[model samples]
Target: MPKRRWLVAPPAPSTFSARFPQFPPLIAQIFYNRGITTPDDAQRFVGMEDVAANARIGDDPFKMNGMSQAVERIRRAIREGEAIGVYGDFDADGVCSTALLTEALKKLDAKALPYIPHRINEGYGLNSDALKDLKEKGACVVVTVDCGIRSLGEVEAGTALGLDMIVTDHHSVGNELPRAVAVINPKQNDDAYPFQEFAGVGIAFKLAQALSDAQQQSPLPNAQTLELDALLDLVALGTVADLVPLVGENRTLVRRGLARLNKTERPGLQAMMQQAAGKNRSMSAGTIGFFLGPRLNAAGRIEHARTAYKLLTTQYPGEAEQLAAQLEATNRERQKLTDEMTQKAREMVAALPPGEFILIAGSPDFPEGIIGLIASKMQEDAYRPAIAMTHKDGVMRGSARSIPEFNIVAALDECADLLVRHGGHAAAAGFTVDNTKYDALHARLRNIAERELSRLELVPTISIDAEASLSDMNWKLLEHLDQLAPYGYGNREPIFLSRNIMVKSARLVGTEHIALVVSDGVVVWDAIAFRQKEALPKLAPLPKQVDLVYTLASKVWQNEPRLQLEVKDIRVADL
Candidate 1:
């Protein structure tokens, strides 16, 4: 792995600290680093103040384009007793959106059928076969979640089949909009929604909220009214898993949703929590991102997404337990496969000519489901935009993960003619191309990345929020940091730079990790450097001192909770 560039935030002005006297200087510096300058913004960001009073224009669900139309269409379907199909992708966000909407609609006495396409067989988005099946099952309307914005052909085919399609996606839109009954994407050029970074499940939550409000105003006989808050647990799960910016409306939603998730009554969630041995741990964004998200995603990656959807929607404890165990097993298998494929991908990239701005690797043996994981690992290891593809028959399907300096989706857009289909965010994207066009597509993408990234430093960077000494590692500092709960994409957990720390003790925990006790001459703290076995040689000399970048964490040892440093990176101290 390449050495990462450390970018530390400059210290906050004394006046800025004075404005928020209640918080420590470290906390104030973190807030400023995140662009929270005013006292009101800082208070609201830390959850001391309510967001409802300071909500943006996009906070109102009705303000979203096509929201009213989508709500009315779904409402009419419920009133007329027409079957509604919720079509979703195979990822966690898609599954959560499908489950959330289906549950919400069923509560309103609507005939709702949830459908998630098979990852290997059906691929992504609204497929004709799935639509035909839904229609044959008596579904008159189909609403898509997490997909369909760029699926112009699929939407057209569904329309020709007489299915009224309502697209609720968050991906970047293509040149032309789908001719669906209603299109609800905040990224639309004409949209007035202030915040445009909602995850697919977040948009589904908004649609559900609008429907709930409509149902409340005009009571449906025998209808069980749904409380929107109950659905936020799904929103939080999908939003965090999808890597959307955790700010503005997304932050507020996750903040409240995490609270609900901790006390979730859903049997599936309860079963999953118990299986992960997290029943006693406080649920946070990291728990969802690392533990819950991967397990939920493993179902789709290994087999079919229907298993995960069932796990989320099931009410039976026995069934939930069975499903959770199955997911656990599947996740283990996925990790193994990813590790093997990543090694192969690295070998392939190593064979490429040096100075290539992008890394591209493909294999007929690579499983289609885990290509994204391989691509992500490639990008992380190489510090460059990376693409991993699975070639089978006459088509090549690929997933791309990019560095912050490059937009993978935009690069794909420039090669639109060469691709059969493509869509995603700036950082990640997926595409399909004919075997004949694969070479052309590869060259075009490499040229784009070279043109764009040649002038920029391509090293991986770790942004440190503040600099603190070993003496600052205390329970009170940890408490103050807890105020910024549910950290993610936009709001990351604060990382501190503590320089020239003496290594009191050091040993290898695993093949790739190091366990150590460090001190600043006055105070000592336990630290763990994950994936840093390469640095062990430098610490071999006893009493070696080094600069450490880390985040504060609490670990239970001997049934006692103790503060520790989760080291991110290490560098030899200056002589």
Candidate 2:
């Protein structure tokens, strides 16, 4: 890994002492350092809500643009005993929403069948062929989750074939919206939803909650009732997997959802956690992002997503075990493929000019399913927006991942004349083009990126909370940090810096880890640098003093825990 520029925020103002006396001085400063300003803000930031009870009232679903109509249409289908199809994408968020809504409908006696598109065969959104197949299979009403927002042509074709469509998606809207029974998306240009940053599955959950509430007056009122909290495990999984900010309702949902995840009754989740996360480990955003989400997404990436949806919906224990094991192996294969592709992509970009604002790489043999992962890896290495494509059947399908300074979807919008279809968020998006247009598209995208991106943003930065003395690291400090539980995107884990610290001793541990005993002269601490064995040369010449960027971490063995510094970056003093 390249050395990162440590960008530490200035210390909080002195008024913090008089303002938040209830909190310890350091705790108050930490909150300020994280952008907290008012006392109420601090209270909300540090306080934990009863996520399970949802004691903090959530937004009403009826307020959403098409939520009421969507609920009414689905309820009528359920009451009339119609065969309904739940169409969804192939990612973790889409799979979870498909299962959650399907299960909710099944309890109402409606034949709710989940139809997840194959990542490779169907690509994304509502395809005309798939719609015809669903209609042929006796589906009268089709509700889409996490997809179908920009499918204007598909929606028109489906309506021509006698299908009533309801779209519940959270992706950014384009010039046209689908002409479905109800088009519900929070990011619409004129949308008035209180919170606009919900994950795709979050929109589905709102629909499920509204349907559950509407069912109170249905003839099947005595049917299995829906518990919104019960589905939070899926919510936590998708929200974290999608990497949406964990603030506002997303935060509340994930915080409570993680609790549900830990004790999830879903046999698939239970078995998946056992295999992916190991037994008895606490659930966190990291757990979902690193373990659970990948296995769930693997079924979609390299295989049909049904493998995961079936795992979530199946009630049989033996089936769940087999599916979870399959996903585990698939995930391992996915990792191997990603590593190989990333290396090949790196080699491709090694010859690019350093000032280029974007990276574009493609090959006919590259699996379209893993293009997003490749784009992300390219962005990480190049520190610029990236596009990775797969050439097949005379077309180039590409996935774009961008830096914060560049809006890739908008860039695609500028070059729309050369593209077949394109839609996504500011940070990431996808598109298709005739193989002949790939070169023109790449050139246009690079020009747009260079014109828009600032040089400062082309460099990766590590934001440190504050400089800390080793003496200040203690159980009391750790206790204060507990209030910031359930951290993820936006609400990230705190990072601290300790400068000019003497290394009493250092040793290379295991295969690629460095363990050290360090001191600030007055106090001593133990530190570990994982996957950073190359730093040994920099820390040589014995008893060296260095500047360290780190996070306070805990290491436990045999039921006893000790504080340890997780060294993120190391710089020799005055280097």
TM-score of each: 0.98, 0.96
Q: Give the lowest summed-lDDT range of ten residues in model 1.
A: 49-58
- Candidate 2 residues 440-551, lDDT tens each? 9888887788789745556678888888888878888787776776778878878888889999899999989999999999988999999899999888888999998887
Model 1 lDDT at residue 124: 76
Pairs clashing in candidate 1?
A: none
Could you say which candidate leads in lDDT? 1
Clashes of each: 0, 0
Error of 1 at 321 (Å): 0.8
What's the lDDT for residue 45 in model 1?
A: 73
**Candidate 1: where is the Cα deviation over 4 Å?**
48-58
Deviation of model 1 at 36, angstroms: 1.3
Report the error of model 1 at residue 575, Å.
1.9
